[model samples]
Target chain A: MFFRVVLGMVLAVASCGAMAALQIEITGGINQGQAIAVLPFEQPAEVKVDVAAVVDADLMRSGKFSPLPRSGMPTGMAKDEELLKADAEVAVTGRVYKEGGAYQVEYRIVALKGADRGKLLGHFKGAAPLDLMRQAAHRVSDRVYETLTGQKGCFRTRIAYILRRDGAPFPYQLMTADYDGYNETAVLKSTQPLMTPSWSPDGRRLVYVSFEGRRPAIFVHDIFTRQRTRLASYPGLNSSPSWSPDGSKIAMTLSKDGQPDIYYYDLGSKQLVRVTQNQAIDTEPTWSADSRSLYFTSERGGKAQIYRHDFATGKNERVTYQGKMNLSARSIPGSNAIIVITQQNGYRVARMDVDGSIYMLTTSSLDESPSVAPNGSMVIYATVYNGRKGLAIVSADGRFKANLPSSSGEISSPTWGPALDK
Target chain B: MMLMAVAAAMSIAGCSTTSGSGAGAEGYDGQGVVTGIDSDGAMTVGDPNEVQTYNGPESLREKNTIYFNFDSDQILDAYVGTMQSHAQFLRNNPDAKIVIEGHTDERGTPEYNIALGERRARSVARYMQNLGVDVGQLSIVSYGEEKPADPTHSEAAWSKNRRAVINY
Candidate 1:
C-alpha cells in the first residue's frame, strides 16, 4: 500500500497546479561502453536547457556509450583525428540558434578513424520552443542512437507512473512525462488510490486500477481527451489490466468467478473469457510479444511464481524456478526474455529467459513492478530509498542504473509507453 | 417513543459522537459517533437525538481491528469475542451496514497482496455471517498495500498495516 496520509486531491472539479518534474540522477553505472565525445554546443542565450548535456546523459544512461566528461572535452571543437587520439570512437558537435522565436539545433555525429573512420552518420536538425529545449535534445539523441545501433531510439517516448501527492483531497495522481522525467502533466487526480498504469500500443490510452468510488475497478483513460471508461467493476477484484498487442482485448485479473484468475475482456463485445481457473491466485496478466499466450504470476505452486498460459494450446507451465518468489512480469518487446521481480536474498528485477535461465538485472533489495521500455533496452522499477518509494531505471544488462526522485510523495507502478512519432 | 428513549439514554451517558454508527430508525438525521464503552463494557453509538447500544466484552470497542500475521488470513482466538459482539450488533439492527477493509503490509507483490488482503477481509465477513450477521449487511474491500495505516516500513508499521478494519 502507499503512504495513506490525507491529501485532498479531488479530481472532478478541482484543478491541479503543475509541480516540478522528477529529477533523474544516475545512481550507479559502469564506464565500459564505446567511447564518445559530445562537445559543448554553441547555443544562443535564449535556450536555457543544456541540449548537449541531455544528449550526453541519454547515451550514458543507455549503458551503450562512455561520453567524455566536460573536462575531457576538447577546446572549441575536436576534429576526427583528435577524437581518435582521445580514444573516442565518435564525436558529436552541434550549434544552436534562434529562428522565428523558436530554438533550432544543427548537429553532426562522426565516427573516428577506427572501424568506420570519418563516417558522417547523419546531419540532424531539431527545433522546439525555447523552453522545450530538452525535447529538441532528445530528438538528436534518437537520431544518434538509430544511426549507431540500427535500432529505433526510445529517447522520444513518454513514461506514465502513479505519483502519490502528499496533500489532502486528491493524493494519487497519474502523471505522464518525458522519458527523462521532465514536462510532467497530470493525467488524473483523485482522493483514492490508483495503481498499475499500462499504456496502449499506440500510447494514446492507458489502463489502470483506480479506487475513485471506494472500490477497485479497471479504467481506460484516453490520454488526449481525458475521457475514461470503466471497463471492469466486478463484485470483487478487477485489477491488473494489460492491453493485448493488437489492442482488441485486455487480459486482466478478475475475481468475479471463484478466485482471482486471468480473464480476457474483449473491448468490442465486452465478453469475458476466463484464461485460468485454478483456486490459487492467478493475477498480473501480461501478454506475450505475439499475443498468443499470457505470462502471469500465480500462487498455485504454494509460492508466488511466474506461469505462462498459452491461449491457443491451453497449456500452463511455470516459467521461473530460480527464485522463491517471482511476480510483476512483463514481456520485453523484440526479445524472448521477460523482465520480472524475482526474490533472491531480496526482491530484485531480473531477466528470465523463456528456457528457464535467469539473469539478475538490479542490485536493490526491494525492487518490484518492473516495466521494460518499448525498445527493450531498459527497465523501470520502484525501489524504497530513505523510507520513500522512488522510481529507478536500469539497463537491461544491469550495468547502468538511474533514479528519478519525486519529492511530492511515493511513486509506483511506472509503465514505459511505446515510442512516439516525432 | 423509541427515539425519545434512545435520546434520553444518550443524554444520561453524555457520550461523544465521533466515528459512530449512523442515526438509525425514526428518520433521525443526526451524526452518530462511537465513544468509550460503559462500565459494563457495552458499545454505544450516540447521535444528537438517538443512541443505539450493543452489549459486548469491555475490549470489543478497542478490538474492532483484527490484526494478522504476515501473509495470513486466519482469525485468532482472542478476537472471537469482539467479532461476536459485532455480529450480534448487526443482528439487532438489520438496517445497519458495515464495510470490512482488508489491508496488507508492504511485503509481497501488490496483486498477490491484493488477493491476500481480500482473503483476510472475507475471512472476517464469513465469520460474522456464521455468527448470524446477514451477508447483505456486510461488504468487503481490499486495499492491499496501497493504504498503510502506518507509513513506516519497520515491523511495527507492518503489523499495524496488516489488518481488517471493521467500519460501520
Candidate 2:
C-alpha cells in the first residue's frame, strides 16, 4: 500500500534558441518540507548569476525545504524574529560583491523559534571566479542544508549519463554535468551506444559499457584527464562496473566463462575474482556502502530479483520477494536501503528497506536505472516524459519530484558521481 | 493468407535448391540480391548490390528478424522453419558471416535488459548451430532496449521490439 502525494507545479523553463543542455523542472509539490526563506543576496550589477536563487533552487530540489517566494520575503536582512513572523523556521541571508578578480560570497543560516532562536546556525565565506560563481552558491546551499537537515548536501556533485541523438553522425555521447544539470560537457562520443556509467569512489574516473567495437566492452575513463582504458573486453559481455566504497575493487558482470556472473576486479592486484557461479543471468552489480557485499540482479529463481553476495561467507542469498521482477538494486549511500526497479503496475523505481518493505518513489510507468545521490536524499533515474525519453529526479521519501529533460534527443543510463574532494 | 504465402514460398524454395535456377521466386530478382520484407509484409530492397548471395527461399530471407514473447527467449515454433532456412543457407555458403543482434522492450532495467538480449541472441545462435550452421560464421551482440524497432509504448510496439535480428 502506498500513498500518492499531490503533484506540484511543472516549472517548464523554455530553452533559449538551440540550447541542448538539460533543463531542470520541479514537477512535484512539497508534502512535509520545512518552510524557509532564502533572502535575495545583496550584490553589485556586475554579478551575472543570481547567487541566492541558485541556493534557493538547490534547497528546494532536495525536497527537504520549501523556500519562500522572494516577493513575500521581508525587505533586507530580516532578523530571526522577523523570519518567524513570516512563518519561516529558518532564514538564509547572503551578500555577494567583487573582491579583486574573484567574487566574494558570505552567507549565514539563522535559526528561528527554537531553543537556538536568534542564533547563527552556520556562517560561511568563500570566493570563486566569475565562471564558478554558481558552484560557490551551491556551497552556501550545502552549508545551510546540512545545518538544518542533518544530512550532507549533494548539490555540488556531478552526474554522468548517455545522450543519444536520433540521427547524428555520432549519436551517443557520455556527458557529465552539475547536480542541477548545468555545465554540461561530453566526456566521450561514439557512433555506437554507451550504457551503465558507474563513478569511481574518488569521483575521478567512470567505468561504463560501450559498443564501439560492435560488441559490449567496459572502459574506465578518467574524467579530468580525458584518458580512457579498456577495462574488460572479454569475448562475451563485460558490463555493469561498480566501484567499491573503499576504492580498492570494482564489481562487474562478465560472461567470458559462461552465463553472466558477478566478478570483482581488484585495482591493486589487477586480478578478477568470480563471485557468483549460478547458471542464470547475473548482472548489474552494485556494492554495499561498507564494501562487505555486493547486491546484483539475478534470474536464478526464474524471475529477476536482487541477490546479495557476502565476501566473508562467499554465499549468495536472495534479497527481494515483493515484486515479480526486481532488478538494478543500487544501495543507498550510508544505509542498507536500496533503490531498485520493481514491476508493479509497470516498471517503477522503489526503495526496498532491509526488512523487505517497498516504498514506491516514482509513479511513472517505465522508470529504470535508479541512482542514489551521495547523501541518499534524492534518486535520479531515466523515464519517459510526454512520450519522449528523459531523466527524472525524485526525493527518497517520494515527497518531491522533478524532471531533467534534454533540449533535444533522449538521455538514459544516468549515474550520480560520488562526492568529490574540494 | 500468411500460411498460404509461406507454403508457396517453401515449395519455391524446394524448387530453387533442387533446380538451381529459382530466380523466378517472388521478391528475388535472380541477380543474387534478396529483398527485405518489412513488418507489413512489403518487400523492399535498399540496394541490390548490398544484399549477399542468399540461396534460401525469399520467405526465409524475409524472416531474418524473429519476434519473442515478453521476458522469454525461447524460440517460438513459428520461427523454426525460418531458423532452418538460415541455417541451411549458412551451411551451404561456408564463408558467409552473420551477426545475431538481440533486443528487448523498454520495460526493465537497461543492464538487465542487456543480459536478456544476450540470452535471446544466444538462444538463436544455439538453434542455428544445432541446425548445422558453423559456429565460426556467427557472432552475437545485444543492443538491449536501447535500439527499438518500434519506439511506441504500446503492446503492439513492444511485441515488435522484443526480437533478434539475423544480419547477413
| lDDT (Cα, tens digit) per residue for candidate 1, span A282-395 | 999998878899999999999889999987789999888988889988999899989988888777899988688889887678687888887888888888866778788888
- Chain A TM-score of each model, in the order shown? 0.91, 0.93
Query: Which DockQ value does candidate 1 get?
Result: 0.12
Reference-based lDDT, each prediction: 0.76, 0.78
After superposition, candidate 2 runs with Cα above 4 Å error: A1-22, A74-76, A79-82, B1-61
Native contacts recovered by model 2 = 0.28
lDDT of 2 by residue, A52-148 (tens): 7888778877889877777666544556666666567888887887778777888778877679777898888888787778788888888888899
Please give the range of 10 consecutive residues that has the lowest summed lDDT in model 2 chain B. Answer: B1-10
Whose DockQ is greatest here? 2
Error of 2 at B24 (Å): 52
The lDDT, on a scale of 0 to 1, for candidate 1 is: 0.76
TM-score of 1: 0.84
Over all chains combined, what TM-score does candidate 2 have? 0.86
